[model samples]
Target chain A: MNAIEIKGLQKNYGDFKLGPIDLTLPEGCIMGLIGENGAGKSTTIKAMLDMITAGGSIRLLGKDARESSALLKQDLGIVPDEIGLPEGLNIRQVEKIMADSFRNWDSKQFYDYMKRFNLPEKKAFKTFSKGMKMKLGIAIALSHKAKLLILDEPTSGLDPLVRDEIVGILNDFTREESHSILISSHIVSDLEKICDYIAFLHKGKLMLCDEKDRLLERYGLLQTTPEILRDLDASAVLGKRVTDYGAEAIVARDKVPQSFEIQPVSIEELFIIMAKEA
Target chain B: MKGLLKKEWYAFLQKPVTFLFPLALFVVLAIQTKSQVILMYLPLYFGILPVTLMSADEVSHWERYMHGLPYSRSAIVSEKYVTVLILSVFSMLVSGVLLFFFMNTGFAVPQFLFLIAAAFAASVLLPSVMLPLNLRFGAAKARIALGVIFAIFGCLAALSVDDEGGSRFQLLEKLAGLNISIGALTGILFAAAAVIMAASWCIALMLYRKKQF
Candidate 1:
């Protein structure tokens, strides 16, 4: 079964509109949503969670998203960019609250994650650092035994060490075949490390969605003179940069002539090129 | 529901002084002055506690985070109403104890019960107006709206005095003229408060459901 399926999702504010987006995340696979700021990544996530009234049909675990029942929520764990626990709540109090909130809450797992993450049990949320807060959020999201996790910018502002640790934890989560994740982040490198599928959003529209490996295979970076780049087919060059010394362009591998050498493009490079082009 | 309450409980404990100061003041003043009139304001204070908590929730952005949880919109709206009711009952119980002590000071048994009922009605009625506004416009804006409402009511109340030594004496005289028993008046107040509270809950739920975080 697919973990999440969204069809024709759209939301409109007076000044901005996010739209008609269709996305599907297959069960047990992680799909990374890559976008720049205001690219509608968070908006799409909100729509899928039914946090906003959007024009769309969303199904989570075969249940309608609008049917936000406790049973449906029990199987879904979510982490927003900022963990929004009351500042005065200590770890123990948060555990107590979660215990009362979720019938399947595992206190042992929570404590274990706290210990592993080096989060202080006695400290209030207000005292925790940003990295600690994020670790705590991830710990809570993992301890609940949720089948699907929706994380929004979970690793955006963290240091590289903390980001790597979080990435490792996410990798561990997907070890279970039933556990899936739909994570949105502007930090493409982190997503590249863990995501099997990639979806790029630019200006509220989905630019492309495909397997990460397929994207890397289909697009290659070409290093040549501006004249050579200019000579290439417009359709072949997805994005380009021409300096006085030389020129570099993202070219469709199949469309490029065999005479030109094509280097594999990283997901970050691909996203930047694609987003800039859009 | 339990989780939301637990959160509020922790929040209450965080600033116990903020929540308990009014009650303590009411107790001290009632004891020192030997007056039951101060008991009326205790429930009014308790009724606004939910709005105060909502301000904290706004600062922490818990309301937005809560949407990611399993709770429905109605549950979210219902929690505030429940919190108001809980605080109202606590205020009533505290006032009941105070009224019990006032029994020796010429306070009649029926009047004592009526006072509690009146306090309860005021407690629920205040939040009935405040919660919907808070849900519709958020905590900060709702606070302004509430201030305007209170100001209007205060002005209307001031106008009703007719310069005849205030409205309290006039109200008592009118009530006496009506010849309604304290028991019947208490029942009417309780029934009116209940109906208003139920309607307020529906309004709050509707407003909250339409709100986009």
Candidate 2:
């Protein structure tokens, strides 16, 4: 079963418009939503979670998102950009609240995550550092026995060490074939480490969505002279930067001549080039 | 619903002073002035407790976060009403006990019962107006609207008073002269307040469903 299926989804904000966006994330796969600030990433996630009214259809866990019944939500673990718990609550208080909130909330798992994350049970949430707060949010999401996780900018503000730790934890969650995740981030490197598939959102439109491996295999960074770059077919060069030393362009692997040397392109480099081209 | 209630309770406890200080002041004033009217304000105070909670939710953005949880919009709206009801009951119990002790000190049984019932009704009636406003325009703007409403009522109340220590006594004399029993009046007030509260819940739920988080 697909974890999420969005078809012709759209939202209008008077000045800016989003979508007619179509996206799919199969069960057991981690799909990374890569976008810059104000690119409608949060807007799309809000629509999928039924937090906002938008046009078109969205199915999550094989159920219509607009229905948004409590039963359906029980299987969804969500970490919004801000961890929205009452700041005055201590970890223990939060655990108690969650236990009552989710029917399948596992206290042992929650506490275990707390210990692993080194979050203090007695410390109020307002006193925790940004990293600790994020870890707690992730712990709550993971302990609820949810089949699908929707994370929005979960790693944006954290340090590299914390981001890596969160990425590793998310990777662990998807070990079970029934578990799936759709994480959005402007921090492309973190998503590159864990996401099986990547979707690029530019402004309010979806620029590209494909398997990470297939994307890397299809695009290459070609470093050659400007004279040679000028001769290259327009279809071959997706985006290019030229200087006195050389010309660097993201080129379609198959479209480029085999005689030219092509280097592997990182996801971050690919996104930057694509966004610049757009 | 339980989870939401628990969170509210925890938040309430976080800064006990905010709730406790007013309660303490009321108790001290009641004792110092030897006035039953001072204690009567307790129910009104409790009735508006949910507004403070709603304000806190806005500050923490919990209102936005809650939409992602496994709760229906109605459940979210119902939780606030439930909290208000619970606080109202607590206020009644506190006032009832205090009034019970004052019964021997010039307060008659019928008068005491009427006061307690009035307090409960007032407790219910105030939130009945405020919660729907809070749900529709949010706590901050709703607060200004509530202040305007209270000011209008205050002016009307002031206008009703006359010389010779005011028309309040004249109104009381008129009420006492009526054939209606205190018990019947109390029952009517209770029922009316409850009906208004139920209607308010429906309005709040409708407004909350339309809210865009």
Candidate 3:
């Protein structure tokens, strides 16, 4: 069964509009939402979580997200970009509060994550550094026996070592096949490392959605003279950038001539090219 | 609901010294003055506890965090009301003890029950007026709005004093002269405050439901 299904989701904020987005994630797969700062990544996540009123349908675990029973949320975990731990409380206090909150709260797992993350249990959240705060948020999201994890920029501002640690933990989380994750991040490298599926959002619109490996296999960066680019099939070009030195364009590798130099295109480069074209 | 209450408790603990300082000061004043009337204001000071908790919630964006949890919006709104009531009742108890001490010391606790009821009414009324504002406009904006509201009330009060050609003391005297017995007046004020609080809870719930965060 699909872990999440969104159809015709849209949010309007006067001059800005985000949506008509459709997405689905099968259980056990990790889907990464990549977008620019104001590209509606957080808005889409909020709508799916029912944190805001939105105009469309969203289903989680085959139940309408808006209509699901509160108990149904026991299997869902969330971590926003900014850690929401109360400034007054320490990790110990948060544990107690969370224990009371979720029926499925695992105290053992909570302590384990705290230990693994090396978070000082007695330190007030306000005193923790930015990376520590993010780690604590992840610990809370994982402590519950959640079947699905929804995270927004959980690792956007962390040291490389910590980012690697977080990515490893998330990769381990999906081993059970019953667990799925939908995460949003502007850090393309992080998403490329762990996400099975990738969705690109631009200015509130979905630009593309495809399997990561398949997308990488299908597209290549072609650098050639502008005169040669003009002769190349326009239908195969996804986006193009013309430079004084040469013209670089993204095209289906299968359709492009083998004689042209094809360079590797990272997801970030692909997004920048498309966004620039848009 | 239990977790929500626990979160508020942790919020209060952020500055445990601040919470205890006011209570201790009020208790000391009641003892030093050797007066039952002084004890009544204890509840009014305790009124700040809910406001403090509200600010703490805002400090870390805890309200937005709550949306991710399984809690319903109504439950979130109801918890603040419950917290205020708890503070009010606890303060009333402490004041009652201080009043008892004055009675034993021959300080003459006149109209004791009425004074206690008035304290409770004021405790409830202040939060009723403040929490909805805090929930709607947030702590900082709400505080500014509250200052404006109090300024307006203060102007009306000053105008009333000027029109009567009397000091604020005379206004107290006028209220003291109301024909009703102290018991009946206390009961009426308590009942009215309770009704206003109930209405305020409804208003706060509506405001919170419409709030994006």
Candidate 4:
């Protein structure tokens, strides 16, 4: 069985709908779930943890998510989109709390992360800056020897240096292929660096789920004339951007016509073309 | 779940509201109602301590953070229940002494047991009513709903207070000639009410477990 499988996950809130989402994350890989602000990233994560009212079949580590939440959460450590640390707690307090809560929490690992991040042991969380808070969130996430670290926008508010540091830590932490991560972020470049698989969600729907290299290699930014795109194959065309200079067709890069030149698109530009349905 | 409970207690001490409101009301009520020593202080005796603790927690959105910890929903829920149970026992001990000093009516023994039991009954009721609501609408909305429910309950209690009549109270007249010791029966009723309070807490937990937070 896959490390994570979500099938027909349905959750509705009046006009807001979460799914009919179907996805799978094979073991021993990082899967980046890319989406915009309101594109149901957090909702899907919540549903996966059985933290919200949801109807679906979800298997994380070969157990039903709802029936086996108590056991499943042992392997799963979730750091939400927002760091929900207690305002009164210091870094030390957080370590104590996490240690007491998670049976597998590694106290030495927690303090090491805190030291690496330069998070103060005595300062209350409320006194920490936004970046420090996110660091604290990261520290807690890494402390538990978790098999699956489900991080939502873990580095959204940090500086590039801190972001690099955190990314380096995550890369090192997952040294044993036994650990996997399903991280969601709007920062596609960050995801590009770590994630082996990529899933794009747009307006509560799954746009595509594929390998990072395949997605990058497959999608091409053809910046030739609009007339050129009109004469080319339309079936494989995922999206287009029209500008005064020319038009850009998000065509399969490997499949581009011999007549026109192709340019590489970064993950962000690729998402801009392919992830948006409208 | 010890993490959640420790955090709850740590956070509680940092805020003045948790102890201040209960202490203020307990003292004020101790001075009211010709000093029944236990019944008039019923608001404090019944639910004040737990209410303060739970309300403080509600204000902090601690449950959301607690969910980040590796704890079963049932364990988290039971911690809240048990916290209230512990606080109720503490409240009876603290307030029972205060009652003795205030009434000077030899209430140390019987009233201690009665107040402890009744206070627990009251403490349990607030969470029993508020927990599911908190799960559905969160702390802010649940606080408003709880305010309204308790206000309505307070009004009903006030309206039922005795008028000048041959009987000490209207409720007393209604139960006249019954061989039951009203005080003893009330203690029994409160105990039964406490059981329902605990049961409702379980139901709220089950509901909250599936609720989107």
Please rank every candidate by TM-score, starting with the best.
1, 3, 2, 4
Candidate 3: regions farther than 4 A off: A69-72, A254-264, B103-110, B162-164, B167-178
DockQ (model 4, Cα) = 0.54
Please give, for residues A56-147, the per-residue lDDT of candidate 1 as tens digits.
89999888988764568888889999899899999999998888877789999999999999899999899999999999888888887899
Highest lDDT among the candidates is held by which one? Answer: 2
Model 2 agreement with the true structure over B92-146: per-residue lDDT tens digits: 8888877676433777778777877888887888889989898878889999999
- lDDT of the candidates, in the order given: 0.89, 0.89, 0.85, 0.74
Task: Flag regions of model 2 displaced more than 4 Å.
Answer: A225-231, A242-246, B31-34, B103-109, B151-179
Q: Could you tell me which 10 consecutive residues in candidate 4 chain A have the lowest summed lDDT?
A: A253-262
Q: Which is the leading candidate under TM-score?
A: 1
RMSD of each: 1.9, 2.6, 2.5, 3.3
Per-residue lDDT of candidate 4, residues A114-211 (tens digit): 77888889988889887788778877877787888888888887789878877887788678878888999988888889988998888887788899
Instruction: Report the number of clashing residue pairs per model.
Output: 0, 0, 0, 1
Model 3 lDDT per residue over B107-171, tens place:
33446677678879878888888889998889999899889999999997777675458765575
Candidate 4 residue pairs in clash (backbone atoms < 3 Å): B45-B119
Model 2's CAPRI class? medium
Sorted by DockQ (best first), the order is 2, 1, 3, 4
- In candidate 2, what are the lDDT values of residues A1-278, reduced to their tens digit? 99999999999999989988999999999999999999999999989877778999999999999886577889999998899789899999999999999999999999999999999899888999988988998999999899999999999889999999999999999999999999999999999999999999999999999999999999999998889988999999988877889989999999988998899999999999888888
Ranking by lDDT: 2, 1, 3, 4
